[model samples]
Target chain A: MKGFLRQDGRKGIRNITAVVYLVECAHHVAREIVFPFRDQQVHLIGFPGCYPNSYAYRMVRQLCTHPNVGAALLVSLGCEGFNRAALLEEIRASGRPADAIVIQQEGGTRKTIAEGHRWIRAALEQLAATPTTEMGVSDLIIGTVCGGSDATSGITANPAVGRAFDRLIAEGAGAIFEETGELIGCEAIMAARAARPELAPELLACVDKAARYYTALGHGSFAPGNAEGGLTTQEEKSMGAYCKSGNSPIDGILKPGDVPDRGGLYLLDVVPDGEVRWGFPNISDVQEIGELIACGSHITLFTTGRGSVVGSAISPVIKICANPETYRRLSDDMDINAGKILEGEATLEEVGNEIYAKILAVAAGAQTASEALGHQECSIVYKSFEPTGPACMPA
Target chain B: MNTSSPQLLRLHEADNVLTVLSTLEPGDALHLGQTVLTVGKRLPIGHKVAARPIAAGEKICKYGVPIGSAVCAIAEGEHVHTHNIKSDYLPTFERENQHSYFQPTP
Candidate 1:
């Protein structure tokens, strides 16, 4: 199938209007810019920092220039240090249209709000009028994350997601599964499955980096309730979590917002890129979704054994239920019943197909369970990273 | 309840514990291989029950791997939780108090 070709030669699954806040100070202006559009594809995204840093700048630049985004309006406070010019240059380099408006320069709040709204409306009109071509499974990059997991997660939904991912990879789609802190114990096993045997060194280095990062931060990603739900160690949780990758050979590692160079299964190193600073890579469900969106995921498959109802601002989330009880209790929020495998109602293949079908439908413009319910839960945390240790990467 | 369908359940042959898809109450007849036994307590959905007697400090298995160790001797069909089991591996996070908090009642 064909796809909507962008100026940068990248194909996009969705044409979006992104209202960007240059700093925390400009959030209101950016949000107001998106308010008039009111289209689900028009989203609000920003960094809350007034002081500029490389990580923040890099993340903002990637997000603004994401293929899914057709155009962007950068809202800035005239006195902030966010470097709006550099960001606009990055977007312009991608050949995507981006406009930066400074609140202080545009007269004041009331006047800037009026000008920002007008600018976004004009951008949206041009964006909406852009012609779109048909897209194929191979052209899609999808990501998966499991939150509020339990024992049933490993037995059903997570593996069923794995199956769907395997099918996607077979169809040449790029798939990413992340959270190395959760995969602590399964590093060696995962390393063996890398597409490039040498890539195994990079794989272990990623997980080890996560372990060291979390250790330095005074917390492991593991929750106390994980033990109550029959999980004993971080490795046990890792084993269950790792199943979401299916059996596809891991291609390579990409930091948040870095697009995959090839189509296959890839591990997203969600841990921060610098020393142990900021906080965790993600503070909640939507932050990861935001990162995936920045990385150019057209959709996200979310597995939950304990039940999570959050969605993202830019992409649709298909929530796959991993536990029979959780499915029963939160059927309204679930798109696939993977728990049926354990209850003997359906096979893994059947559930996997159900999830894959849901992906197609979502891509075709059908609202997911989370989308229909309007659950736009988003968050981002801070973390500083030190480079990977030699043993952490694949051998 | 139909306890006759234990054969339908696939307990990882290498695992020391088995997960019950349905709830099991105390005194219910349970069939495990050639061994016939009665449930010792009511196990909730998604909870694990020891398939066989496990001695103190012995590794408790799940999914064919040692998830943790038994803190005390546990009878078959007993509910396995923090009180009866403790993780054998050190956690990745720093802890000020290094002692286990699990204590089995009887």
Candidate 2:
């Protein structure tokens, strides 16, 4: 498969002009920069932390150099702790154009905004003429996450996404599914799908780690809305959630920022390695979207039985509405309706094909509903990990 | 017609209860393996039903995991919700006047 070859030997499916905020204080300026250039492939995404942490730095660095990004403009308030120079250097080394506009050095808001606009215009022009390679399924890295689940999720959208994942893996696309906290009761089934038999134990251990971590936090990721949607127990929800992974063998386990070396089906272990520290692996759906982008997913298949209208900061999010009634209310925000399967109007394979087609179109530069509606939300929180346990990354 | 065949529902093999996919009124017959039981109450879609007789203090199993335990004795095919079942971990909260599985129809 051909792609826009980056200096780091990575391939990009889309050429995106990224506007980044250096600190929470500079987010307004970054949003302003993207407001004017929201057309085409210009996207606004950044961490909103005036006080910098190592996790934010690592995530921001990886996200800036992500293959989907072609050019980046950093908005800094000048006094923030973010290492602007290091970020810019990393993007430069990856062969992507990057520039940092310091608010203090530029004399204030008006001048800085003017300079930032001019810099973005010039950077977009330089990046506009870059050559792109012919791309195929092999060039794609796809991830899946389901939120706002209801009873229909397992019967419809989740399984349909699983079918699509199966086809993607068969076609040599890198596929990933995450949310360890949601895999509580289905560990044995998940372990059976591991690439190696010995890796099965590691799979169970990862889910156990998530359960223990959430238990320590005094609240499971499960919400009251889940019960209203007919999910009686955490295990019931886990069984339904596990359907999104399909029957493909799990290729490997990857941390939040770890990109897959080989394309197959990889389990993104969203739970941190040690004791409860970060509060939760994900505070909300968008944060998980950010993590998927950091892991190099160019597009995401988001299944929602309860109707979630969220899009990622970098990649396109294809919303697959699972419940027939929810689809009726949120049709404008959804890209595909797998709920038809539950209504007996369509088969899971048919809906899966529809989702797959939407993915290709979105990857080819078509805007997703969330993207067109300007929902570029991002979040990164502080977390401490004690390192992988003995059974985590098993031999 | 498929008498010998096992019931197919969302309930895992390890589960002691089965989920109701459609509403069932009292006296409706339900078959699980060789056991045939009549509904004690109307079970709403997406709610749980007792697959076997459950005594108070017995753990409630779904997807083979203990979500909570029964606070009252529940006969097989009886509707399982806040009225008869309760959570061991959290307070049992209910939506007042809202339709529960026991209420067969609106």
Candidate 3:
């Protein structure tokens, strides 16, 4: 397959020009700036918090310089705590065309919006000249997350995604599965799959941390819809969600912005480190998608039993519907009918191969159902985390 | 696909619960090994039913792993859910505006 090669030597399947709003005050201006280019690859992404956060800053920096991004326009409200200058400089240093427009300094909303349009016009021209290079399976980094889960999720879609992940790892690709809060009961089983023996305790510790964090908050990741869909408890739901990880040996643990150095299966720890200061680890599925994209995932496999129509701003999301009835009702929004496995129409391996093929097709420029339907959802919330320990990433 | 496919699926040999592959109503026959049992209640697709008698406080196994523990004695072929089982880890969050179609037993 072919990909857009960045100056940092990283390759991206998409070369999108991102219009970023640094604070909630600049969100309208950023949206207006990208409104005219809605049909194009220009996407709007931003952090709504006026309070500066290291996690948010690092996430924005990584996203702006993501391999999928060709150019970026930073719209700041001038007084917001986010460091606009540092972020702009970082993006520029990555050899990508980047500019920052502070609303307070640029007169007002109208003036800044006008300036953003002109900058985007020039950047789009520059991005059109980005060089393409040969991209192999080894160059791909894929992530998986299961949302709207039910009993069928474990039986069909999640395990099917696990199969696809296994195949991807064998072909030398980086695979990531997250939501440590949902993996409550599977810690021992998951830790046993760690690449190195030292990584096992670290894995166990992270899940324990997630459990403690949720316990303090009085809510696990379990949702009302999950219980209504027949899941009895958090651990029951966790076992279903854990099937998305497949059977690969855990290579490492990654924070939101930590990109994998080599091709292997990595677990993304979405829970905060110190305390549960932030409301929920991830308020919505979109937040997890954003975190995955920040870690440089080119494509995300989303398994849903009840149904989820969300797609991310940077990378394409392939929705795999696990419930046959739900699939029948929402077929237009689903890319793969993994529910066929439950209905005896298809086998797990067959559906897995189909998913693997769909990933390559999406990377080679095929729009997923979510993308075709214009589902470019983006969200970033305040979070905090300490760096991974030495044992977190074993060689 | 066959229209008369099996309505219930036993995921693991050690599992005490069987997943309903299709909505089962009272009197629907469930084939389990050498014997056939009748559904005792209206259970929706994706819900779980007890494959055998489960005593109170016993671990509820699914996928060959303990998902939770039964809170009360459950008879074979009876519906198994939050009303009868509780998480061994954290509490499951339930929204106040829960759907009224299925009410939890007090």
Candidate 4:
């Protein structure tokens, strides 16, 4: 498929402008800036906290320079801790035009919005002029997450997605599986699949971090809706969720904002390492999705048994329904019905092939069901993480 | 499509329970195996069914891993779920007083 060529020699499957708010106070102005251009590829993302966080800054920077993003516009409230200047420099360095407006200095909301339109117009024109190059499966980075999970998830959709992940990794594409909170059980098995057997300790430690972090929060990433769908235990749920990583040995472990330097399987440790001060890690699925995108996932394969209709801004989410019953209830929102494996109709490989093809199609500029339905869902929260040792992702 | 029919799915040979592939009523028969059993109760598609009779406190295995323990004696083909099982790691987070699911013993 044809790829959007960025100035840094990286290929992008999409070319969209991102409007980011440095803090929550500038959200209104940021929304107004992208409101008129909503029908196009404009997505709004930001840090809601007023306090400065290196993680948030780095995450925003990674997202701003994502292959799918053509340019960025930063909105500041003039007093938040987010490093707006550095962020602007990062986006510009990627050879993408970037503009910023401080609400206090830019004559407040109305004037900022008016001038924001001018900047967006110019950014879009400049993005349209970016060169196009041919891209293959190897250039793509895919991530998987299972939500609204039920028993059918492990038996059907999750494994099928796993098979698809195997195929993608075999083709030299990057694959990421996350939500250690969901992986409460099955840490040993996961560590066993580490590319370097020595990396097992770090792998186990991350899951340990999730277990402790969740224990303190009085939750385990288990939502009320999950139990309603027939998942009796967290280990059962994890066994179901774990299949999304396929059989590939994990090349390394990654934190939410750490992009994979090369292609292979990597687990994102969403839990913070420090004391439990900031609330629960990843308040919802969108936070996980946002993290996946920050780490450079061009598309996410979202499997659901109870059915969740959420697509991401900047990245497309291909919904794979694990329950036939749920698929019938929300067929329009689903891209694949893996529950057919239980109905004695389709096999796992068939569904896996379908998912792989769907990824390719989505990467080729086709909007997923959620994207077409305008489900630009996203969320990012405060998190603290200690950098990994050299063994985590050896240079 | 009105084609959601009941079927039994066994993910691993070592699994002591089979996932109820579809919503099933009691007294269903199958040519499943020599462990010859029939559905003993109504069960949801995603719920678990005993592949064999499991004694009280026996580990309930799925995906070839011990997910929980049977609180009481469970007969072959009986619907194996919350009523009969308890998570071995941590309490299964159900809508009803659901807590955390634990990590496996390292």
Candidate 5:
């Protein structure tokens, strides 16, 4: 497959120019700047917090210089606590065409929007001249997240994704699965699959931390619709969600923005390290998708039984439906009908191979159902975490 | 499609509950191990049915693991849901008493 090669040697399936708003105050202007280019590969992403956060800073920096991003235009209100200067410097260091527009310094909204338009137009031209390189399966990093889960999710889509993940890892591609808060009861089994014996405690500890954090908040990641769809308990829901990891040995633990250095299976710990300072770890599925993108996932495999129609800004999302009734009702929003396994129309291996084939097709520039429907949802919220321990990623 | 195909699926041999493959109405006959049982109420697709007689506080097994415990004694072919089961880890959320699924133990 052909891919957009960055100066840092990372390959991306999609080369997009991102317009980032450093603060909530600059969001309107950033949106207006990307409005005219919305039909193209330009997208608007931002952090809404007025206060500074280390997690948000790292996330924004990683996103601005993501392999999928060709260039970036930072929109700052000029007074927010976010370190826009450092962010711009990091993007520039990555060899991407980077520029920043401070609204306070460049007059008000009108002038700043106009300047952003000019910079983005020029950046697009430079990106058009960027070189392309041949990419292999090993160059790809795939992530999986299950949203709107039901009982069928575990029986069909989730396990199918696990099959696809195993295949990707065997072919030398990096695969990541997350939502530690949802994997409450499966920690023991998951820990047993760690690549090294020392990494077992790290895996178990993260899940234990998630259980404690959620108990403090008086909620697990269990949603109302989950119970509505025949999922009786958090652990039951977790068992289904855990199947998305496949049976691959865990390579390492990753916080939101920590990119894996090698090709293997990694678990993204979405739960914050410290006490629950932020209201919730992730407010929506889009936030998790953003975190996965920041970790260099070129494409996300989103499995759903209740039907979530969200797609990210930088990367495309392939929606696999688990329930046949839901699939029949929302077929247009779904890419693969994994419900066939339950209906006796297909086997898990067949659907898994189909998902694996779809990943290659999307990497080669095929639009997923959500992408073709113009879904570019994104979000980043306040959160904090300490760095991973030495044994978290054993060599 | 085979019209006579069993609609109830037992995911694992040790699982005490079977998943409903398609919606079944009251009085629909279900072929359990060596015995035929009739559905007493409407069971929707993806819902669970007790594979055998289960006592109160017995672990509700699915995927060969305990998802929760039975809140009340459940007969074979009975619907197993929030009304009859409780999570061992966390409380399941329901919308402002809108659904009759969960009943507080008095």
Candidate 6:
């Protein structure tokens, strides 16, 4: 595929113009502006909180300049706490078209939304004229996250995604698997799989922080559906969830907004450091997806046993159904029926290859089941992080 | 291995529990290799059943990893889930069992 080349030398599969509401007040205007342009790739994302959070600033900056995104429209409610100027400068520095609309100055909601439509259309036309460069599996970055996990997830979709990750890494592409809380008991095994021996301790310490954080919240990462699906403990779920990384050696660790400089298989550590002053590390699966995009993931593989129908704003989300029954119940939401492995209808390798092909297909502009169904779910939350440990980013 | 269509999925060879692929009723016979268990109770699909007699306080194994510890003796063919097994990580909160705020049902 000919990937859309960015000024930063990164390649992107999708050339999207992100219309981001700076705060909750401008969300309506942003949504209305993107409504008429069904033919163009315009996604709406926003930080809804009124508070000025450093985390939100970094997240919005990262999203605006993400490899998948070509340009960004900052919709400010005029007096919001977000640093709109910094974000605008970052977008402009990326050599991408950007426009800002302040609701107060632009004649309020009705007039502003009309003007935003013109700006987005002009940006879309400009992006369409942008040049694209040759891209392959090696030039792509992929991430996997398991949601609505049931018993079949570990044996089917997660392992299949892992297999895909293994193949992607072997081909010199970047692969990422996240949720440190979900990787509780597998630290030792994961550490042992680190590319270097020294990376082992850093791997262990990250999970330790996750364990402590979740313990303070009076919960493990395990959900009620997990228990019903026969997952007994957090560690047990970790063993299952860890398979999404395949058997590749860990390369480096990345906090929420850090893109991998050199990637093999990175653990996207979403857990906040220093103190757990923030509420939850991630509010939902969409937040995790958002972070993956912020870290420059081009395509995300979402494996679900209970069926998650979410597709992200910028990057494409390919849903893999892990349970046959759940697949039957929610086939419309699924892109790949990995549940076939459990039914003996398909092999794990077959599903893995299918996912790999699906990724390439999506990268080449094939709409996933979620995208085809118009499920543009995007989320971002505020959380502080004490910069990653030195070992977190391997040399 | 069962001569007929298999009813269970074993993730690991060392696992003491076999995940039921289909619901198994009492008196139904399930054969796995040389071992067999006459279902003592209804085992729902996707749920686990003890493959052998499990001692109290013994680790519950699935995917050849310790999922949790059993709180009571679980005979072969008994259901293995939250009822008897408990996680070694955070305690699975049972609101009704807490003395601080849990009120006894009248």
Sort by lDDT, best first: what order?
A: 3, 5, 6, 4, 2, 1
Indicate whether candidate 2 or candidate 3 has the larger lDDT: 3
TM-score of decoy 5:
0.97
Candidate 6, CAPRI quality class derived from DockQ = medium
* True lDDT of residue A206, candidate 2: 85
lDDT tens digits, residues B38-94, model 5?
A: 888788888998989999999999888899999999998889999999999888886
Q: Which of the two, 4 or 5, has more TM-score? A: 5
DockQ comparisons of all candidates to the true complex: 0.31, 0.19, 0.73, 0.50, 0.75, 0.50
Error of 6 at A311 (Å): 1.0
Off by over 4 Å in 6: B1-5, B25-27, B32-36, B93-106
**Predicted candidate 6 versus true structure: per-residue lDDT over B53-96, tens digit per residue:** 99999999887788889999998767888888988876654433
Model 4 TM-score, 2 decimals: 0.94
Residue-by-residue lDDT tens digits, candidate 6, A266-381: 99999988787767888789999989988889999999987888988888999999899899999988999998887789888999999999999999989999889887788877
Give, for candidate 4 chain A, the lowest lDDT window spanning 10 residues.
A218-227
Q: Write the number of the candidate with greater DockQ, choosing between 2 and 4.
A: 4
lDDT of 3 by residue, A161-275 (tens): 9999999999999999999999999999999998999999999999999999999877789888898788999888999999899998999999999999899999999999897
lDDT of 5 by residue, A313-372 (tens): 999999999999999999999999999888789988999999999999999999999989
Least accurate 10 contiguous residues by lDDT in model 2 chain A: A386-395
Per residue, candidate 2 scores C-alpha lDDT tens digits across B12-35 of: 676777755444677877776678
lDDT against the true structure, each candidate: 0.76, 0.77, 0.91, 0.84, 0.91, 0.85
Off by over 4 Å in 5: B1-5, B97-106
Candidate 5 lDDT at A333 equals 96
Candidate 3 B-chain TM-score = 0.77
